[model samples]
Target: MFTRRGFVKLLGGGFFGAMALGGYAFGVEPLARLSVARYVLTPSRWPSGLKLRIVALADIHACEPWMSTRRITSICERANALGGDVTVLLGDYAAGMNLVTRYVHSNEWSKALATLKAPLGVHAIMGNHDWWEDRTAQKNGGGETFGHRALAEAGIEVYSNRAVRLEKDGSGFWLAGLEDQLALLPGRKWKRASMGGLDDLDGTLAQVTDEAPVILLAHEPDIFPKVPPRVALTLSGHTHGGQVRFAGHSPVVPSRFGDRYAYGHIVEYDRNLIVSGGLGCSIAPIRFGVPPEIVVVDIG
Candidate 1:
């Protein structure tokens, strides 16, 4: 015979344990379904200059139970359908440091990513997970790392603290990307080392002129306030938009600024920031309120 209090305590513990196990199962299983959605962001600066269509995809933590080759290929097909002038992948391509080797060996996965096509081309940057997994030694023998080289081989330009100039008609704009700030943590050797200082935009923007607007692509939205004024627009996707958002409010967004830049479009000062909800799951794999997204920005 147990007291009421003791019975309640035992039931609560059991329920929590079941939830934890369920979460683990969700994370380690492959849910290879695809959904396509688009967003239109009109920047204030160039209101009627270039009609730039940008498709942004981020945080596809492809691992044991999250994503698969079929899913990636499906996403690529949808992106192509959007017919955006440029396709920007905001990082976290792999699940974690330990899963890098497994993904590299999966030829089907690599080929699926390689099949992603865009007229202007696809550009990407490294995320924390990418650095963590790629920079670690595999339990299985063989020296292989994940970073720009892998994406490059697949025809996706990896921009780590670098910028590329895109020209349309007679006008051109700058596209800049930074290495994951999380890589700077102690005891980790990032595959693509980031240039120190969050305020260090001059080095990345050296090639760009004041004539055209600058679009900055950083993996995490935490660097929003740090980005230079020269950048007219910034795109990020690390928070997963609280992945499991409530009906009217988002859960605790793990960032220094709380829910200030949790998800969706936000205007800060003169810079326009768009934080995508991302396409896949991680940590606790189940996404309740926040579904995956593919943001489409039509710059006119």
Candidate 2:
């Protein structure tokens, strides 16, 4: 029942539709939603009367065309207003590749974060890009500083393969963080790809005691499977919600575990995993289906 003219029209329409979708995914949608996804974590060990508000920012690639230092400062101000007990940054503060070159100084970004208000304190960890990008090379002429010093200088305690205790209303739990998992790149020696050095889960976990509850921060979500169930929760970022979602499914997830560990919260066996979509883009400046986000998780 179709005529030649009708078929041509159909093809033309389909082409335009594809173009429109691409525009939405790459340009329009990426900027449209600074979505906030919230979750409630009820750990049995956590007393009911007390609650912890955690504001997590991930993959904040602080450079031009995407996120500048000014933009990051705005994000920090917004996070401060949220009135969280703790603030955590999951890394990737600077872009690894050239989307734009006028990269914001890491130290400046940290100073902006210094103004963030959290009674429990603001903590950070590095992503693979932070190491491989060589942001710390200029300081020690390429020794392993990672980007920890910048954040730390801004008063944000940057932890790698270490544990620290956070007290809330006289009850405290051990909060731990790990170095990036795929830390060692193919041609590197004695270093993680971040080149800030290595990831030592065993070393970090050994510092924690069995009596207190533990929440571990590991940047890459794929490491969740390796985390012990005894740890109450593992918070991570790096997937960027697969960076683009179509029909509610994202095809670009970079995890070794596929989309299974891609984004948001997941539970396998008795262990829990929380993977954030994070806040910025990596290589491509355009995002189609996925909108940038800041995750606010409540734990009690």
Best by TM-score: 2
TM-score for each model: 0.79, 0.90
Q: Which one is best on lDDT?
A: 2
As a TM-score, model 2 comes out at 0.90
What tens digits encode model 2's per-residue C-alpha lDDT throughout 32-98?
4577778898865566666788898998887775776777777788888887899888878767558
List runs of model 1 lying over 4 Å from the truth. Answer: 1-34, 97-108, 136-145, 188-200
- How many pairs of residues collide in model 2? 6
Task: At residue 156, give the lDDT of candidate 1.
Answer: 76
lDDT of 1 by residue, 14-117 (tens): 99998975664344322534445555666667736688889889887775435666677777788778888889999887774243324533345556777777
